[model samples]
Target chain A: AQSVTQPDIHITVSEGASLELRCNYSYGATPYLFWYVQSPGQGLQLLLKYFSGDTLVQGIKGFEAEFKRSQSSFNLRKPSVHWSDAAEYFCAVGALSNTGKLIFGQGTTLQVKP
Target chain B: VTQSSRYLVKRTGEKVFLECVQDMDHENMFWYRQDPGMGLKLIYYSVGAGITDKGEVPNGYNVSRSTTEDFPLRLELAAPSQTSVYFCASSSDRNTEAFFGQGTRLTVV
Candidate 1:
C-alpha cells in the first residue's frame, strides 16, 4: 500500500546552517504529500503540503518542500537553521479515500548546536 | 485551554478511557492519534457520530463516537506496550488540513 519513509532518524546541524530532510513515498497514484513538525511534548504542526500544483511548496515557519514525482519524494528544506527549528519532522502521504487518512514517515529528529 | 495533555495509568486489567472533543464542528475525528513511534499510525477514525472505522493499527483498541463533539477511545486491558503519546485531530473535510490537540503522554507502567 501507500507508505512514507524518512531515511534520516536523527540529524544535527549548527545554527545558521542549511538543512535538508529526505523523504520518499510509495503510492499507486498521484499522492498528496505533507510535512509536519512536532516540538517536544507538543502536537504536530503542518509545515507544508504538495497536492497537485508546483513542485516547490512553501509552508509556515520558513519551511519549504519540493515534490519530485519521478523520484516519489517530497523533501523538506531550510536555508538557515535556528535553535527553534530543532524538532521532529514527519513526511506523510494522504490516502486516496475521502477519509483524509495519512501514512506518515518514521520521522527525523533535528538537533541544532550553537 | 488544552485537553488531555497528559495521562499516567497503572497496567491493570481494567480499561482505560481517552476522550476527544472538537469545537470546530469537524466532519472527521481521529484517535491514536498522531506520531509517537515509527510514525503516526491511525488507530481509528470517525466520519461522524456513531460512525467509526478501523485504521492501520486497530487491534487491542476500541472507539465510539457518541456525538459530533466527542470521540473517545477505550483500551480494554492496559498494557505496557501501550505506553505512547496519543493525539487527537479533526478536519473539516478530506482535502483540508487537520487541527491537532496538544497530545496526551500516556505512560502505562
Candidate 2:
C-alpha cells in the first residue's frame, strides 16, 4: 500500500531560526509528492509539489523541499522561520492515475516562538 | 475568493449538512475530514455531474450531486468522532492543482 509519513508530530522553533520538517513516502513508481499547510480553522494551501526534474523545489512563503529518491524522502525546509509560519504541515503522495486521491501523512504542527 | 466557514457546532443524533459549489467548471469534487494529530482523510468524491463514490470512511456520511455546480455532503447521525473539519475541493483532470474551500469545522457533541 502507498502511504506518506511525517515522523514529527510537533516541532517548536524560535522566530528566524532555520526549520526542517521530515517526510517519507512508500510507493511503487516515481510518485507525485506535495506539501500543504493549514492554518487554524482554515483550508489547506498548497506549498509545493515535486513531479520530475531537479531534486530541490521552491515553494511559497520562503519554503523549499528536497526530494531524495534514494531515501524515499521529501523534507520541507525554510532558511528562517516567521511567526506566521506556525501551522499544521502535511505531506501527501498522489496516486499514479488521475484518481484525484492523495495519501497524506499524519501532520506535523510547528510552533514558532518569539 | 473562496470563503470556507469557521465552524459548525451540532449535537449528536442530529443531521448535519455541508454544501460545496464551485464556480470553476471542475470535473472532480472531493470531501475530506481532518482531526488533530492526523492527516486529512478522504470521505467521498464525485467525478462528474452524477458520479459519486464513497471513500475510506463512509459509514456515517452521505453525499449527492444536485448538478455539475453543486455537491453536498450530509451526515444523517452525528457522533463525537464526526466533530472535525471538513474540506471541499474541486479540480479538472487537466489541472493537477486542486482548489480548496475554506473548510467547515463541524462539532458534534
Candidate 3:
C-alpha cells in the first residue's frame, strides 16, 4: 500500500520565524502528493500539491512545496510564520488512486509563539 | 448556496476521521474512522464529478474536478469503519488533486 510520512510531529515557531514541514512517501512510482492545513474548529484546507512539472509548486496563503524525487520528499515552506498560521498540517499521498483513496500522514501541528 | 453536509458523533477536539465520494468515477470520500493512533481509514473517496475546490475550513476535506463530477463533502464527525462503504474514486495527473471529507463521527461504546 502507498503511504505518506510526516516527520515533524509538532513545531513551535515565532510569528515572524520561517517554517518548514517535511513529508516522505512510499509508493511504486511517482504518486500524487498534497499538503493540507487544519485549524481549530475547521476543515482541512489544501496548501499545495506536487504532481508533475515544476519541482517547486506555489499555493494559496503564501505557501510552496519543493518536490525532491531523489529524496522521495515534498517539503512545505513559508518565508515567515504568522500567528494565524498555527494549525495542524498534513502530508498525503493519493493511493489506490485509481480507486480514489487518499492516504494521509499522521500530521504536524504548528504552533506560532507570538 | 445550499452545500452538502456530513455528520456523525465526535468529541471536542480529536484529529482523524474522514468521508464520501463515488465509485462511478474514482474521486472523493467520507470517513468515520476511530481507535488507537491512526484509526481506520474511513470514507475513502474519488471524485464522481468534475469540479475543483480547496478546503473551505481548516479541518474539513473537499475537492473538485475539471472533466468529471467531483467529490464534495458534508461532514459531522466519525464513526466505525464497519458502518458503511461505497462510492470512492482515485485519479492523478499534474494539476489534478484528490478528494476527502472533514470527517464525521459518533463515538459509541
Which candidate comes out best when scored by TM-score? 1
On the 0 to 100 scale, the lDDT of residue A69 in model 3 is 89
- Which regions in candidate 3 have their CA more than 4 angstroms from the true location? B1-95, B99-102
Candidate 3 per-residue lDDT, tens place, A1-114, comes to 677888878899999899989999888887788898877544567788877899999999999999998898999999999899998888877664354446778788899998
Name the candidate that leads on lDDT.
2
User: What DockQ does every candidate get?
Assistant: 0.75, 0.60, 0.19
For all predictions in the order shown, the interface RMSD in Å is: 1.1, 1.7, 4.2
Residue B55 accuracy (lDDT) in model 3? 21
- Candidate 2 lDDT over residue span B21-68, tens digit each: 899988888888887777988899888988999887778999997687
True contacts kept of each: 0.66, 0.49, 0.17
Higher-DockQ candidate among 1 and 2? 1
Number of backbone collisions per candidate, in order?
0, 1, 58
TM-score of chain A of each: 0.98, 0.98, 0.96
lDDT of each: 0.85, 0.88, 0.59
Structural similarity to truth (TM-score) of each candidate: 0.95, 0.93, 0.66
Error of 3 at A110 (Å): 0.4
TM-score of chain B of 3: 0.27
